[model samples]
Target: MSVMQGDGRLKSQRFRQAREGDWKRLERLMDKAEKGSARRLSDEEILAIPVLYRSTLSALSVARETSLDRALIGYLETLCARAYFFVYGSRSTLMGKLGAFFRRDWPMAVRALWRETFASGLLMLGGAIAAAVLVGQEPDWFYAFVPAEMASGRDPAASTETLRATLAGEDTSAGLSAFATFLFTHNARIAILAFALGFALCIPTGLLVLYNGATLGAFVTLFASRGLGVEVGGWLLIHGVTELFAVILAGAGGLRIGWAIAFPGDRDRLDAAADAGRTAATVIAGVVVMLFVAGLLEGFGRQLIESTPIRYAVAGTSALIWGLYFYGPRRRPAHV
Candidate 1:
């Protein structure tokens, strides 16, 4: 053991001596660049940085394996770390990074989860259709599906005249500020739950999403029975387009997480979940922004605009903008 240690020490010293010239040259050049501006370095010096970096990396790897002198190892580590920032770390400003994220990263991630998105969409649609059909067949099913608190007196018992009054009554609903805050608080909780509970293999997420659709369908069916379907559609659409889309995206995020856990393929389960969670979390954060916009629309615009055509226009415009943002043609992505 004593002989082995002495031999290792000799090798380390020889290694350092042979490379000392290049190391000194790199150190001098880096010091000069650090003193003022890297821009001040000549093109030759700039080109040499990466070449020096690769050699230094090889030296560090050898140092770690051979268990070289602690001071020598420490010096190499510090040098490599400084070079790594210039070579690999992002140089963009915070706002520039934020802009690029929405423009590229977010949409690319959504496209990657297209299969999960389709599954979530199908589940919600199936729930909505089933509820609508059942309620349409027998009016009593509306009460079973929709909660009384959410119904707000708009149910099967409401006459056509009474249903019309919702659109006409300006001061009857909660004030704009209070209502928006309330809506944001409520929907945000549901969205977060649908995301957080996905770890349980997506059973909770599926149920929550299904329930979301059922309530909407139940409301529609109740209004349709009273011959005020068109009015209610406009009333709902103004905010529903953004809000419902946000909820759907949230559900997609949960499903993505669950799917990763179930089918890790080559990776370990934790690693697979972590990668999916990063992308899914980005989508969910954007959904919160969507919900904020929806709350404003629901509180301010939906209450004030009784014109069905204009309401449809607002909803259609929102849909078109989101569609383009997520699914429109994009530039070829640069390597990150």
Candidate 2:
């Protein structure tokens, strides 16, 4: 036989052997191929590998029987990496999760907020009212609710005068600005502490939030019955709506951490807490933004509006807007 014909036959035999996983023959062909001879696989080809416990076994079978199609395996790896990116990557995945949360998880968040607010805060209101009633029956008992220094500011007969003074000049722009700034910073720190304390367990943080709400309720009720209700309510509504809501949200976050520790659902306590923390952090991020806005309004707007009717109008509008946005419809399909 001619030398050229003999070489042709040798090449054909090598090709057949390579198809059967003859590594020696396959290596020879790889060496003979031109530089950069690797083929790219499509996305569909990559996704064809069933993602399961048996996936590695299946890929191995293909490799051993089919001359090790590295392209296919590479494709599968790429697909997996992409899936992981979508689920956990910092940017796209986080945005997607946020979208899902606003659309799907918002309702759950609202429900949690409502549950915590009423169930927890209501007790404080009741306690304050009971305290007030007792104080009426036993005049000396007023000291229990009002600290000595605060009592000087809590004269029952001074409500009208106090409100008028506040409207006139007591809570001037500079005073309001300083007070609002202090309150904002103080409250934010407390909220963070409440959330962080949940790591110790959930109950402590919950009690802290409840106690805070109770203090506010008692304080407000005292002013309300003193005839400063309209003025005090107006002042609070200007910024209290957002500030109080943030506090409630922080409590909910703590509850989430506590629930993870106490219940854990389908995961171990640590894992559950980590997952819950992610969601809670998202909620807190939103809350922090709101607190900043509230601080601005309280500092700037609260002092500008002097007329009671005008203050009430602004306060009422603010309350309504907050109510609708937070408890309003979820951003996405409820099923998700």
Candidate 3:
């Protein structure tokens, strides 16, 4: 038994000694990679990483099978795990990842959803037109579409002077910062809900988006009845261009998922939905950013800039920027 134990020890020591040099080299490479110094490595060293990693994996397998010293086995296990991640895991740094997302992933995802976006925009438009016609014929329909809390006395019952005063920035119950935060939260909630409810065959998402447009139409019709149409248009458009677009995109994201589930074609239902989800997720991320920008515009720009023409100009500028950003032609990335 003593002699057998001695032979095993000798075998373990020889095994480690044979591969120790390669293991140390791999460790050095891992250290540099972890420290973000991989660019400093020579081409030879960079190419050697996978070779050394595979060697280390082989060593670990041997150690486990041979029941080598616990400490030695543990060392090989740790080395192999680190080497696996260093060699095979994502190579992009944090900032690099963010740059890729903005430059490629987001815009690409939005472009892919053009069909869904058009459908969503049409739904919103249809709802708005329907509500406007209804309320134009019977002002009482305003109460049905616009919630009382949101109306805040801006309903048809309010006097023309009172309604116009609201658009003229007369209401100042909340600080600008607080108001911006509130708007951001509210808009984000609606956008996220629209995205989340998309899996329910898209019915909820469609209704939610339509309801939002109806509310907007109700407000517009109410103001139009009092001859404040242009004023309200400017007031809403200053931020609504971006805000409404974000909502539309959110609805589109949900609709994509719903459509996938409804017509999976040759793919499994879950698989199709998953594929759509990846693209939708990217759009949703960009939508959050759009909502944030809209919140700032609504909270600050809308309040500070009172000229109707200027508001329209700002809205047009925003629309132009968004159009060019999403629809402009660019060279596709190789990886994408």
Candidate 4:
């Protein structure tokens, strides 16, 4: 063996003979090497120590009798040194942990499904606005966006007493179930289309979300003009704030992916697009979850609560949850 290997082996043997309680020799030897030499320990050296030592000896084991109980000391030193070099020592450990969460964590699962939530919410809002505008300007425009059934229900000719009877009663479980099921399926379909169509997804999604926004804008505007705006605003604001924001966020996520493919800087279009898709998906998942929560509030909370303050409370709470999950401090797991 070369002189350096000979010296290491000889010193290792000497270390084994030292009092087990005296770590001075081991410390001196480590200190004598380059200041950061631990960072450069070979992968082979690290792997071999673990394999050779197994359980009976520390990773720093040497075949020699020690007067001192240095075996444990040596083993600990070696193990820690290797860890400090390869695992926790690397700053990317935190990032790796985050990636794992996104892949395996429960919160990440909810986030993953958010895109769908936003898509459906936006579509509903858009259609509502477009129909409202048409109804206001042409009185016939409402027919284009409002399904025939909904229009028939809202018809002025319908008995005022009958309309009150329908709107005033306790919301039926059947109605809530139907709405929830519809929202879930509809939202998922929109999210998939948003992700799949790339940039092309933007136009349809945007139109949908915008149509909703306009419908809402018009709804409140008309109600206010008719002196019922305060009541209408109170009711819609309870959930509208959270639901609308979620839809916009989802639309932005879709656009983000689409633009990446359309204008991939330097990287091949496919690669750039793929990279964009990954980030967009991460962001979109958060949006979908927000929408789902919003839908629950809109479908159930809005229908059940006639009080304005209660409605705002629900809206505010939903918004708060969204802010906390996506933008709040990420709980980083401890590294092994």
lDDT of 3: 0.92
C-alpha RMSD of each candidate structure in angstroms: 4.9, 8.9, 3.0, 11.1
Query: For model 2, how does the per-residue alpha-carbon lDDT over 88-201 read when each residue is reduced to its tens digit?
Result: 445435789877666556546556556554543554445556666665565455555555543446544455566346543234567777866876787788678767777767
CA lDDT, every prediction? Answer: 0.85, 0.61, 0.92, 0.56
The positional error of residue 128 in candidate 1, measured at the CA in angstroms, is: 1.6
Model 4 lDDT, residue 114, Cα: 60
Candidate 1 per-residue C-alpha lDDT over 115-206 given as tens digits, one digit per residue, 9 for 90 to 100: 87888788788888889999999988998888887777878787778878976526645677787788888888888988887787888999
Which candidate, 1 or 4, would have the higher lDDT against the true structure? 1
106-203: candidate 3 lDDT, tens digit per residue: 99999999999999998899889999999999999999998887787988778888888787652463777888888899999999999999999999
Candidate 2's C-alpha lDDT? 0.61
Task: Assess the local accuracy of residue 320 in candidate 4 as a C-alpha lDDT between 0 and 100.
Answer: 84
Worst ten-residue run, lDDT, model 2? Answer: 25-34
TM-score per model over all chains: 0.77, 0.61, 0.87, 0.55
lDDT of 4 by residue, 1-336 (tens): 699767866776665456433333334434533365655656665454344334224434433243233555556557447444443345445889777655445354335436644554556565666656565665444444445543436443445454444433256978886775675555556555555555673566566555555555544444444445556665666656665665565665666566677778899988977876776676566656666766776667777887766766766786787667654667676799
TM-score ranking from best candidate downward: 3, 1, 2, 4
What stretches of model 1 exceed 4 Å from their correct place? 1-80, 168-174, 265-267
